[model samples]
Target: MTPFERSRGSWTFPFPGLSLARSPPDDRPTFWTRALGETPEVYGERLREQDDATWRAIDPTRSKLGAALCKGLRELPVPPRGRVLYLGGATGTTASHVADLVGRRGGVYVVEKSPRPFQRLLDVARRWPNLFPILGDAREPRTYLSWVPPVDALYLDISQPEQAEIATDHARLFLRSGGGLVLALKVPSLRKGGGRGPLSPAEEASRSLSRSFDLGPSVSLEPFHRGHFVITGHYRGTGREA
Candidate 1:
């Protein structure tokens, strides 16, 4: 099989983090850079050569979601042409990849609380018509609930101790039956116990999610993104009482 080979089109890549890696838009050379790092000068997108096709490089090493997928994620669970509620879309790096996955028929409603990141999300939304960026706090789903339509999936990348609670609130308000969800749990942000092992904050989050969502297999984003766990699943039952 060719490196470019996948179940999807020629533009797509097998790596889920990078939905599709087309030849770099420009002739600019692309090289690896650390995630969340600032570059010295403005450089256009770069192409990564696998076989004959030069793929666009959306480094999974640079993204936590991408790292999790590289570590061993199974499925996206996001249906084609489905609506999605994206919580904590920061600058649209991962969100942009997700928007590509959904395509024009599908839409992603991104909620960002802070203004700085929200501005970046807006820029990404402009390029991708399917993306809808909303500047609102995720703590209160009702605050921006009207901006988002009922969705088939929900993705959260927020960094707060109340990650699970926040996910539950948004899920109840937006996700429909059998809807998919991917929650990125920032383990270190959660309260740390006296000792640590493979045990993660997602465990508590998953247990909390049991009240409503049936979770799928979870994996840790170690080495690439230490102290992060990825959770995938769908809404299952009425959530736990407050």
Candidate 2:
């Protein structure tokens, strides 16, 4: 039988670490991830109990990765039981879901620069032993080199002008060759008030990423997040630094 059964609103496993179901009264599609352990309601997401599994809905408006999935960007590199290094994991909203997706066997090394959000992230980490929180700067990826291993995928969502540069830098050091990459590129950061040039922000970011990665589709997070695009790629490990 297929994962999604329309006759009964049962949870369907689509991507690694994710579940899908139709919401009641409307039949609208909903995204969910299985909770690894006893985790409190970190975010205000609804939880459902069915088939002896607890699932939490991923809020697209709050999570860029969730918005990318809801928007139908399919090249997710994060595999089941694979390691991931998540940059800019603010308060662990998306990171929590990722941890659930990776399950107990995999690990998620989350790096958050700020202290306030990092504190909240610490609280979330306690619930999932596999989640390791690092309070450090993403711009300086080497600082946390000891904390992370050669990951199967790298997820970047920092709000910096050098978004593409940062992703490539970290990928070079941590991600294995041909590993998957997901970047949440904020358009305004790249433009910096500059008028539209021959290349759009997404195009410019793509150009920069093409140096170190075999680029894939770039999905736009529209109403949920204006001026944000999620770019997926595979690290080639052959291109020179941009």
Candidate 3:
């Protein structure tokens, strides 16, 4: 089976954080990421050690990105040693996993506006060499643009009315022409009455993003997250490669 597929309730690891083993015969597949460093439990996730490496179980219920992967997201832009700029990285739960995926060579620059969670994110970043925390609003990307370098992937999970617009602005600024874009579209944040006619909020966001991105596999985070869609694609803005 491909990395994204679930065969008989068992999953194959997709990218950098590969699985150590298949799930038990009676249980469903569990996703695991190799711990980045000598880490303590973050968010109380289960941990195990094998082959001289620590692995942490990623709970889909608490993570939109994990939910998308659990629901069989066909494509993920994050590659090993790939730099990522993560917006709305609340308390570093999901950002920690992203750091594990990228390993020591690559880094994840996380931006969070709220001071409360940003404090916790700072603590998390202390333990993770590859994780960087920035206290700034994702909507105003320029506020933290100086801190973030050009990245291979840009991920947005902000709860804002202009999520797509924010992503577009950041993509043009930080993402390389062929870099990846992963966004968690929150429907409730869209304009009341669903914004555009007939089309759902996810569709509307996808349509707007299509102008600059070559949209790829879009997954619904159902059962784990309601009214959430994880959109994946590559940036095709000006000067894109042929």
RMSD of each: 7.2, 4.0, 3.9
Q: lDDT for each of the candidates? A: 0.67, 0.82, 0.81
Candidate 1 similarity to native, TM-score: 0.76
Candidate 3, position 158, lDDT: 86
Q: How do all models score by TM-score?
A: 0.76, 0.90, 0.89
Candidates sorted by lDDT, best first:
2, 3, 1
lDDT by residue (tens digit), candidate 3, 112-193: 9999999999989989999999999887788887788888889999878788888889988898788988899878887563
Candidate 1 residue-wise lDDT, 1-98, digit = tens:
33333333432233332333222344322222211112211123344444333334445555666666556676767876678888889888777666
Tens-digit lDDT string for candidate 2 (31-77): 78878759646699888775677778888999897798778776577
> How many clashes in each candidate?
1, 1, 0
Compute the lDDT of residue 139 as modeled in candidate 3: 71
Select the stronger candidate by lDDT from 2 and 3: 2
lDDT winner among the candidates?
2
157: Cα error in model 3, Å: 0.3
Clashing pairs in 3: none
